[model samples]
Target: MTTFTALTTLDGKAPAEALGAAMEGLDPAPTGVGVFEMEDGSGLWEVGGYFDAAPDEVALALLAAAHGARPFAVSQLPEVDWVAHVKRELAPVEAGRFFVHGSHDADKLPEGRVGLLIEAAMAFGTGHHGTTLGCLRAFDRLLGAGIAPRNVADIGCGTAVLAMAAARCLPDAQIIASDIDPVAIEVAEANLAANAMAGAVTCVTAAGFEADPLARRAPFDLVFANILKGPLIDLAPAVADHTAPGGHVILSGLLTHQAEEVGAAYARCGFNPVASDEIVDWTTLVLTKSG
Candidate 1:
């Protein structure tokens, strides 16, 4: 196991930053990867993993592809096995009736309780982040209120956490989960299988609701979009198009400051905001389409 640190110029940081953000929700995690915005307005990324050969070789390859930098300063951390450390840090959390773990723990779903093991690899929605957790809580509330969606679509379904939760909650419901990234689709499929839900959830690689076939199959009874603000705004109409009359939508992954803009986007799509929940800097909005 080895850890490598690489620095990037201001211009070189953008690609890696995007990749890091895309991967923040992966399960089993992704090589303990992270990008830090430096105080000097530059960027640095740290990656650690197990390697049978020279660690720098792999590190250089990743940096070259992500940051487009060659010979980017590589420093090794002595006496620290970062791969093991990260796996330990990402160990599963069992709280109350929910057992949350990385993809590796997928087979270890708790007995008699609904299991949601996500393998985020390099996407978001592993339930560790506050936004994901908030969405999960919101889903729980919806279920508690006896809101069982007959058709559900998890837009931007990074790792498919929400889709799986919905499937478990509504055993007879149809689920469609999609992500723009191919890697996320793979992870989501693995997660659905790990939760013994392969038969119930459909996973695909799609950028937005308009690009997904399931969205065209039937109007969704509920839709979950946990994407960034920009895409969320742009996809609002498509979301409305896929949602049935009087159907529900769960929107998250925005700062409180951005809620108004997001809400306005949905409102324009004929979704009336029913509730908004805030936790820390993140906000989750529940909206329903007007008949």
Candidate 2:
């Protein structure tokens, strides 16, 4: 069945969330509503709703106006098997010793390499995005240099792909992967099971490093944070506090232009950039805390 989407953006979270809540009371009620920040540090939040039937445009416009948001844009969307589309566009990705592929390409996993099974169902952190690829490569390069981390964390670990890679490389390491969205935590758990890593990495639902369990396991030898620039900048101090002396961090999910600013924030927290990877529009940085 086809669907319709009504979307609007506002300057702050309050109006965006209010608008999202308003969508639920529409005549042709939305199937779901979502509010998310733009992640660019623009302070803009987007409100969107999906509906099986076309939403009442007048109601949408009234809601937008009431929330001081831009006029809502509604459009019909064709039904799509997003997983199939993802599989078609994302071929197997090789980053250093890590081979990330969908089950359809299972036979392509080469010998003597860490294979990460990331089905199209979970698109984020599938090692296909430039950010994820850059992070994986950075991690592999670190391992290749004979540096081993005993304790690690994958913040905002969408599918826990990074954490799993570390698990594969350093079998005895303690790994914790977390995300604020419970759905992402669920996906991470499922991906871990699919890769026969059901309990290899501890999965948690928390915002950034806020989980008490993560705090208890502080001073991690390495941390993988592939979230966008805004949150990365915001979490710099906390990340630095949790990183062991001389510990390493692989940071990404920033555009090429945003890396410098994000790196500068972490630098203020006593981190020094050790390696940088640039792929197309994304940039990933590896940094070390001073011992």
Judged by lDDT, which candidate is best?
2
lDDT of 2 by residue, 148-176 (tens): 99999999999899999999989999999
- Relative to the true structure, candidate 1 has a C-alpha RMSD (angstroms) of 7.1
Candidate 2 segments exceeding 4 Å error: 39-43
Over the full model, what C-alpha lDDT does candidate 2 score relative to the true structure? 0.92
lDDT of 1 at 241: 79
How high is the CA lDDT of each candidate model?
0.71, 0.92
**Candidate whose TM-score is highest:** 2
Please, what are the lDDT tens digits per residue for candidate 1 over residues 1-291? Answer: 554444333234566566545333333234545454332212343322322233444544554566454344446657755555545667665533466776666777778767777543533566767677777877777777878789999988888878888887788888888887788888888877877878688887878865647756669989899977777888887888788999999998878888998999889889998888897878889999999
Alpha carbon deviation, residue 289, candidate 1 (Å):
0.9
Clashing pairs in 2: none
lDDT of 1 at 74: 47
